[model samples]
Target: MEPDKLPLVQCSLALLAERLTPRDRVSIVGYAGNAGLVLEPTYDKEKVVAALARLEADGSTAGGQGIELAYRFAERNRMEGGINRIFLATDGDFNVGVTDIRALIGMVERERDTGITLTTLGFGSGNYNDAMMEQIADHANGNHAYIDNPREAQKVLEEELSSTLFTSPRT
Candidate 1:
């Protein structure tokens, strides 16, 4: 991943945080080789921002593990009738742990049925797995988007916040 995209991701996150409702619970997970919680699920926007602020770009991406940890955190603090989703923003594919595409998709499909969704935001250009991102989102009952600028980020994270975060009920 290019070193510069971190700032873009952070900028996009700032927009996302600004648009979140006070009742919205958010968890920030940054994964590379090893997955760990950057912030636990919380309703405080400032706390989310602070957690985001602490993120620095490094290591190979262990995206599957990252999503797993994200889901665990979201599941733990899930609200009865509110959005419980994981928004994964990345510049590339899962190159380290649990890197198999089929396995990852299967895992996401199973997790989606558990009631939490996964949205994927692909950033930068080369080495980015657009297909995997979209497929993962589809199976995870969420959305996938490629953001090239602040306007696009605003479109996904702010203008269309509800669609991006809210999972629809089955008929």
Candidate 2:
């Protein structure tokens, strides 16, 4: 991963924080070799942004583990009638744990059935698995966005935050 992409992600998340309300809970889970919770569920946007800024992409990407951990946090802090979504920001190159596409899709489908949708934020360009990212979002009743620059980030994380994060029930 290019070192600069991390800053873009950080800035994007900061922009997202500005849109969140006190009732919303935010948790960050990042994975390389293994997934770890960077921030616990909190309404404190500052803490969320700080955690994002501290993130330094390294090691092999355990994309599946990262999604699983994120779901756990989201489920734990889930609101009864509000949105419970996972924004998976990745290059979509799952070289490490749970690398199989079908298995990953199955996992996402199960989560979606339980009302936890996934939105894939594709970061970087080369070697980025656009197909996988789009498929994951499609199967999970979510959306996919490629964020390669600050303007695109603003468009996705700020301009379209409501529609991106809050979707109507699919009948």
Candidate 3:
């Protein structure tokens, strides 16, 4: 959650954005405290950063709300032009809210039908929640990665843009 680490995440998102054919929608579900804020698909960097910072300061940091928000956002996006994905960037801490891992995974699995993949980016180390991150991404038909540094983030954004952009068909 350092200032320096943000650019890496943002850069990754930006890289992913470029590959989007102007028709693709990228929604962000960011959680900080007990609240989950859904950001509409947009390529505006400053607005995205401000939204993320506000959520970071709000403080509940619940992953379940974040997931819920993403699912709902995807549903809404689907009505428009179908959803590309819901990207969750966090340290993987799911406290102060729904803490049941199995239940959360179940919810994500159900949402996968909406055609929105879930990609999780784990940041920081001391309080990271690897199990939860892996479960959500896996169940949602997406991949999870740990971003320990800015460089790694850029590499992921620049390199894995395709895999991250394409959603798996519901099985």
Candidate 4:
């Protein structure tokens, strides 16, 4: 990933952070060669911002591990009536670990019953697989957005934050 895009990601995160309240919780999970929790679920926006700042986009995408770890965190910290989502910001490449699309869909489908939705943010060019991102979101009963620049990031992560985060109860 280009170093310049880091600022755009940080900017988007800041915008999202601005909208957060004490009732909101954030967890940051990053994957490169492997997946790890950057920040545990917490109400502190500053902590979330700090975690995002420390991120560097390098190495192959280990999306499967990342998704599994993210789901684990979401399940553990689930809010009874509040939003439970995993915002997967990626270039849509899963080069390492469970790269098969069918496998990915199955994994996401299994988590659907947990009431944890996925929102895929497509970043980067050339390697950005919009189809894969859309499929992942669809399987998880969520949404997908293609964001190549700061403006698009703002539109999805800031201007439409509420719509992306809030969902009507599944009846």
| Tens digits of per-residue lDDT for model 4, 62-99 | 99999999999999999999889998988648899989
Question: Using TM-score as the measure, which candidate wins?
Answer: 2
Against the true structure, candidate 2 reaches a TM-score of 0.92
Ranking by TM-score: 2, 4, 1, 3
By summed lDDT, the worst window of 10 consecutive residues in model 4 runs over: 162-171
The C-alpha lDDT values of all candidates are 0.81, 0.83, 0.69, 0.83
- For 1-171, candidate 3 gives per-residue lDDT tens digits of 465345455655555555655555566766667545456766565555555544443435777877787777677667445545777877547886788889888988888776677888887666678888988888998888888776777677777754566656546
Clashing residue pairs for model 4: none
List the lowest-lDDT window of 10 residues for candidate 1: 162-171
Candidate 2 colliding pairs: none
RMSD of each: 2.0, 1.7, 3.0, 2.0
In model 2, the worst 10-residue window by lDDT is 162-171
| Every model's TM-score | 0.91, 0.92, 0.79, 0.91
RMSD of 1: 2.0
Query: In candidate 3, what residue range of length 10 has the lowest lDDT sum?
Result: 51-60
Residue ranges of candidate 2 with Cα displaced over 4 Å: 1-4, 168-171
* TM-score of model 4 (CA atoms): 0.91
